[model samples]
Target: MDFGVTPHDGLPLPPRVTICEVGPRDGLQNESAVLPVAVKAEFVERLVDAGHTVVETTSFVHPKWVPQLADAEDLFRAITLAPGVRYPVLVPNSRGLERALDLGVRDIAVFGSVTETFSRRNLGRTVGESLEMFAPVVARAREAGIGVRGYLSMCFGDPWEGEVPVPRVLDVATRMRALGCTEISLGDTIGVATPGRVAAVLDALIASGIPVDSLAVHFHDTYGQALANTLTAVRKGVTLVDASAGGLGGCPFAGSATGNLATEDLLWQLHGLGIETGVDLRKMVDTSTWLAGHLGRPSPSRTVTALAGTS
Candidate 1:
């Protein structure tokens, strides 16, 4: 199904923007307190009912590294799977893919980095090596009739290298797509991207003849630029976007990276612009609110607080 990102005249926005929420996986990955499996399942269900069609459910990695997601299998099993909604989980390697397949998951995501430093630190491999590692996994996934999405981290900026050039990101993106990835998500892992730079990168790709449909945007709001950056992408004819509810996830490798853009905030902005996200702003807010109450804190989504403040 085409995520409705058709171009509209004179407007700096797409006709449709599909938000693939990663709060359940990316948002919760770094938290010290482990949420109960039941709580997480309930949260995802409410989100789906609220109109999130694509949810990043969990990561299939070693528990030793990310202890918070140890119950990945349990969480995947417990969630009452919805028919129309698609749930994609991050699988670090073949072992992760096996785990996902064991549960009969329909979609899976693989990740790699454009920078050598990021690749080494995050996955203990070089950028080229990481792609090589995912080659078979991607191939097998396609053969199994499951969908694959590739996350290209540090596409715009790198923590150690700094100011990643567009050419480097392009190379990785091409390789990932060739590996059978359905959507190549360019991630501003540290949220250092600005609107101009985001457009420049996307434009560069278009010049390279990569269709925008198979692309998604993932931004971190560290400098409060994720929304603006996302809007810029929308204007450029890109459709699929990745966001987290309540700005839950932050990049563990990059200092001061912040979390992904808040789902509620993005919805608020998109709705105002007359671009449909098919997400119920109130239900999204409520799910995050429920989680926040259990965690004993307020949400990080400024839009959620500003608009729903009276409630």
Candidate 2:
């Protein structure tokens, strides 16, 4: 319980970090067992109860492609939106954005790939075509006075095409930023990023005139380097992080990808370092454990398992 630690000299870590909980949307969509709408609603509410300010509620992709989140509208209808909590949904295109807008959603995100292969596999379009698809969505969202987030997957590496070139990643990121994306989340979709690579990518972005405050990091734990990569990003001045509760969810399109960095585990590390996130570690662990039970499995988060005493 005592997370006190002596200060390290000149640590560039931010004093506070904002955790964007993606369990309800990103986490549940990849799940094989489709949970009831009420349960998913409860999961989002519980995350809010645990002091998460931003929770990705669901995606508006076609039900045929992602059946797990087909109940997106139903889930929104079933849940009570807490005041001051930002619930963003994923919108794959113009229609997806329309669906989100119909539900009175204030924030929406568009997913893109930095590589041509992943763009074709995931979005069914090439990288250039996907960017063209997002341009209108981002423009309309901004015109509607809605906040738009751009999710660039495979920022570190890709499964089909191997390690993606840094220039290609930067080009897509710059394009997204030009499209009026208020915030951009860099995704380690395959969990192949190390601390050095993380730093290099972030530094490149910074050099390209991307503000650190406008950037967020989303890392996976496939190679057990997510925490280290996240820490490196945080120290490089990124405050926003995307994580799934219980370390749930992987890229369905990328077979080699693994679960995201767990909210509980990220919280444990951030809180231990005396960085404020406003999230209750105990409540987050409890939320993860509760959701794990519904998923018929134990939590994948080390912190959750240790805190909840679930083997």
Candidate 3:
């Protein structure tokens, strides 16, 4: 498949892309085992050493909800923060925001859902109610000089509510942007989005006045369409993409939502298309390999699997 092409206007792809590594947080959150703070810190540091600038270190949610990341504060304090590298944590509400702020975190991300069922199931609120909840969180984060990224989950299709419309996703995204989120990441949580669906959503978002630069794409490889969907988004001029090192995480709410788009897998496609991600593929492979050992399993990333076989 020819994955390189501007889907519209025949424009050249961006010179560089930003890959946000969400392994430490999103990747491990759904795992059955909880890694110790020291190991988690080491995993993050290795990712930074591998050249990821925006690494999502952890989430500030309640420990009972995501016990895997219960040591968010300790993990954040233990990691060595390098200059020019961002450590963004996921803050689900004002309480999470407060926790992040207490640790002097500069960047945080908030999540919202397009479908009513997902919002209610994932956040214990309706769609409108969830946005209302995020309003104060985003406002206070901005007041505290924190950069907020918004995540809209189940953008393409919801397991409970199948075939979500683009406008519904755009509506929530627009409100998120208005809530002062610096960027919005459209998440295909169930991995049901194909390349055409991905392109359609991006086109609708861009056409609705959302700057392509302010948008990011997050895909799960459950159905093996992540790279293709990513390519479609890039062709639509998106610059920021989310991936997990070693393809670690899945959505606990969505039963079928499996492994995330792997950092190594996304890098392979981006590098092949001549798009600079400022990431060392070899180093990423090694990091994924090391992480897989810690997880006591082989990496789900095709690139990591292939490279490991050859190495």
Candidate 4:
């Protein structure tokens, strides 16, 4: 099907979009180089200064699982939390939630999976067991009036289980919402999604009483489809998009997964389409370039490479 927008299609593009910058958390977590807590703190500060309203700062997952972000508490303590900017952290379970609560985190996210294989592999639990584990976490966070975001991964396709159906994604998404998640981020984990599939998933969600405003899209550029998929989502009235600076993340567990949709690249597309993200493109590119230097390599972001001469 033609994914291009026509005036008569009854699909008006969003005037503005909120970019949830996941560079410091998701981006850094998958990297081979473990940056210092100070550097990670600076990265969070830089993203906020560049006009990112919501930034995923760190994960409270155990050190054994993700050693790179093991200093979650230290990083949270080091960053100077700015006013009016959200700094959400990922909490794997109640223990993770306790750590975040101890540090006074106002926003937290729970990661879930659509496919059983990914759920088992990523969380070491079956689909039901994972949600069962998240039940109390979500309940506690809601009780404390914290903003909870549910990230549903492998929404389009999974590495172990090839193609993921729309219903399967909807089931997990619905459960997550019922569990008191304020927002649900649909993750194209391996980036195998195309415009058609993107539309199908959004359509299903909207038809099932899920509001478009509460939905977010997280796409990977593994198959070079992240931008196209994002455009399709925006045309469908999705206002929140998740991206990482310098294209710096992949699923360490899923070998087929590649880097996330680069924040710079997504900004280039959104700005070109007359969408307001409140993000300064130049500053974002500069931040990515600086980060690439610390990582001892150039950024994988096309916009960053083209504008900043990171090579």
Instruction: Give one digit per residue, the lDDT tens place, for model 1 in 149-231.
Output: 99999988887898999888888888888888999899999999999899989998888878899889999998989999998
Q: Model 4, 142-208: lDDT tens per residue?
A: 9999999999999999988899989998999999999999999999989999999999999999999
Lowest-lDDT window of 10 residues in candidate 2?
2-11
Best by lDDT: 4
Compared with the true structure, what per-residue lDDT tens digits does model 3 show for residues 242-287?
9999898999888999999999889888887778899988888898
Candidate 2 deviant stretches above 4 angstroms = none
Stretches > 4 Å off in candidate 4:
1-10
- Best TM-score among the predictions, by candidate number: 2
lDDT of 4: 0.93
Task: Note the clash tally of each candidate.
Answer: 2, 0, 0, 0
Ranking by lDDT: 4, 2, 3, 1
Model 4, residue 182: C-alpha shift (Å): 0.4
In the predicted model 2, the residue pairs found to clash are: none
Pairwise lDDT winner, candidates 2 and 3: 2
What lDDT score belongs to each candidate, Candidate 1 first? 0.88, 0.92, 0.90, 0.93
RMSD (Å) of each candidate, 1 decimal: 3.4, 1.3, 2.6, 3.3
